[model samples]
Target: MEHMDSSMDIQHLLMMGMDLYRWTFHDNWSEVVEQYKNNAAIHTMPINNKEDTALHVAANNNNAVAVKQLVDEIKRTTSAVESLKKKNGKGDTALHCAASIGSLQMCMCIIEADPHQGHVLIEERNKDGETPLFLAAAKGHKKVFFYLKDCCVGESIGLCRRTSDGQTVLHCTLYRDHFELAFEIIHKYKEGIVGFVDEKGISPLHILADKPSAFESSSNFRWYNWLAYQCIYVKPLRITSHSKSQQTALRGSTADTENPASNYISEHENVVPKNYWTSYDIFMAFTRFIIWPVWEAFGLEVIKTSRKKKEKHVWCGQILDGLWKHKDVAYVGGRVKAYVMPKPGRETDGPKGDAKQSADGGSQKVTADQDKLQGDAKQSAGVGNQKVTAD
Candidate 1:
């Protein structure tokens, strides 16, 4: 088991692959640890065409135990931080792999393995300029996204929260229909990202508008499902003023700027929930238990779907209100208006239908099309009967 550097040696190693890489790809943690005991270089050796090390394979495969073991083994023989920073062909580090796959355990294992400089992983962008935070949000991994987001502070905040294409995490979350998370991002980083426009000149508001199904007007539900939707109470989401003040204080603190861990605030810290169930909760639970079987038996998932749609609608409104209140409202509003309004030449001439089957049935006159026809007749028929033209 000699360390090889030449291309021929690398090819030979690829042909007769090392035991450590083999065990890692197949997820044999015990053998992987045993191999590390023999040679620590095995952990950092390129394992495949992608140049993925054993640690990269382990992290991508999401073996939390293996990742922890390998991180420890790498720490003893080499700089664990340097090994963690090693990028594959796509320039994705082990942390990026962990974040993309939505493995919170693996992410924590990798990042916390090097706490002093773990924030470096969060800030490191791939070839596409996507930080691990952007990948987490794009993949709809809320916990991993939050963990990576909490690691971002000051300048790293903007770097981690946005991509090279100028798309922010808010845009990704909205495009993925993660309305609740999008709403949280709106309030949390309103000053920086609420009004962000991507390279395509699309804002978060434009993305929200594209999701018509999120609005009540787009939902065509049955009467019963709509009733159930109204009955099913969803607790609205809001960030408390205390949390806002805390965020402000954290941003202003110079000490927190250097240490990403210090900027984290638990999601539950500001909430003081009631210990006992309310009467409404008891009643709702009873009603749900009684009718839940019928609801499921008939495959009437609309109740659940409706609840989700309503929640999305609520969050959408809240997000809009928050953005409207931001200092960049004029900019955001103008961008949204531009996106929503039909371009000068692209506007539809009128409603799609024939003149004979008009909604007013020949009684109404002076419609745009008819006015155009009348104007045409004025040129041809000399304008005398413009007011009395027959159908």
Candidate 2:
């Protein structure tokens, strides 16, 4: 319970076990026994200026070997779970330190050492309401983030969680230009997260829309931009293809590398929609999702008398309205549908080889049958047109 200053005495005490802390960072485990035997009390004693235990110091240093030994040595006397859970001055356990440092090995060492309570430890939040996975994301540590993600398999989907500031790991990725990681969050978390507006009232789409410059710097900008726009702008539509061949064509040419989607839009059969989506849907999405927030915050303003008048342009909505009113968008013939991209969310919803092959095959068969029914309806319409011409 005592506070240890950063002074030499504390440094010297930390030197004992914390030397093992440093040594483990270099991955040297030799003579660890003699070191622990010589000054067991001192090393186990409160060490850092913040009074971080030896384990905390080791984790802060990203020393997996030291963390493992300390956990092992301590497991004999006290519970490894409790020791790993101990917090320092900043309310961070060794796991928190490891996560912030983005060291997967160090984190795994601590977690594996205390398997009984590791899940609790991994999910534990610091003062910031950020779990270890969140810290890894904040640090741009994808490998560490991935390992921790696997641990949250069935139950804690909150692994893709937000911080106290209402920033998810997806936001953290974009802030650091980890483009792929941003998509990973969208694909992994799906609808449960995609609709969530953070404390700032900004959805993930808002994040991408704000950072257009990010597209310029991304190495896989084509893929990244396409994916971002899909999650941010298109996913909400829930659009579907009209025919089997259309779906197959889209599945093959999703990327520009093979065949651009624009080619299909201009040349191929119009991708028919499954449901009716009206102008209001577009208006609501633009106003509520995009335009209103900006309009409310920084849109056109005029000063009248003693007060300033803020006029809502509802600009995003206005743009959609203008486009529809202009007759530039043609609804003639079969309605064209955009090709669906296979992203993380799509992984479980993809091909015969993936996600429950038999079930997916059945769904495909159902789709084929629906396509046939539509084809028969079109033939009947053709016959009706011919009879009217004869009359």
Candidate 3:
């Protein structure tokens, strides 16, 4: 090989200096810290095509030593720490990128370099509206989650901040099956769950119920099941007075006209109303609590039998009788009557007497007057009783 020229030697030295800077970032070498202090040229070099300064690359890679060196170099050259205001293509400061990756050490370095960078923590959102904490929670990075949590505590920044879809990090944790993290977040921020609806009007319970596959797939399904069960059973701590008033109105309108007007007018007599909580709401809430545990403990055979189309009426009839027996407990002292409409194969049997049944049944005196009024509409017109009583 021909002898190397001084010009080529100088170019080689420059390339070596640039490579040293890149290697310092890649390996987090401490020696480069000393060299960076002496040579200002190495301080300003970019690594690769990302236009990342030595500081940006080291922070992105979580190289704490290399980051310290670059920070020191900038402070030495510019006589001010503000020269560290480098940003990449996405407009992320080095702190933003490091926090996105859950780099705790680099985060501390940047924060210590300038506590003002904490503002950037909340400001930096990826294309998905994910803050640093959001990404950390999504990844189940508990340390990072708490780090961001402490950063936001008492800082006028709500940790329960919503995503574009209106999902708080807690919602995401639940959806992603990060159950432990979800519980921690909920415990820390109890109100986080209340009134949190997704893009759909679905509440958390609705979301959980609609995704049976997720329920089945979770490795810790028992824990999730128990949590869901508890959530369902824990009644709303504060019931609105409006709901109470609506219940009272329904009770007043539906009370039996035969009862003494004084009895109907009594405040205690009409305390609990019917139809306040619809059957569907009670059924869904009760089923959510009971179905999984009951199914798992005892196989679905009993439930399946009760659920069969042919047996539905029989089961419902039994359930109605059961409710009638415990009406005081079941209905909370409300008026309780059981009326089982005749099934296709069944006949009325002249309204057999049952005290808990409707008054018509308990009366048992099927007078002609009552019969005429009960007559089918088709025959009643011929009877010329234009009273046109309903069957």
Local accuracy by lDDT, each model: 0.61, 0.48, 0.44
Clashes of 2: 2
Regions of candidate 1 where Cα sits further than 4 Å from its true position = 1-16, 240-273, 276-294, 330-391
TM-score of each: 0.69, 0.47, 0.42
Tens digit per residue, CA lDDT, model 1, 112-194: 66678888788788888788888988887766777666655543345534545667787888888776677677666654555
Give the Å shift of residue 218 in candidate 1: 3.2
Tens digit of lDDT per residue, candidate 3, span 11-125?
Answer: 8657856777667555746666666677665554555566566677777776565676667666666532344545555555566566666665555555445455554454455
* Location of the lowest summed lDDT over 10 successive residues in candidate 1: 350-359
User: 196-265 in candidate 2: lDDT tens per residue?
Assistant: 3344444344444444232212122234333332233221212122232332343222232112232222
| Alpha-carbon lDDT of model 1 | 0.61
Local lDDT at 324 for model 1: 59
Which pairs of residues have clashing backbones in candidate 1? Answer: none
Q: Report how far residue 334 has shifted in candidate 3, in Å.
A: 27
TM-score comparison, 2 vs 3, better candidate? 2
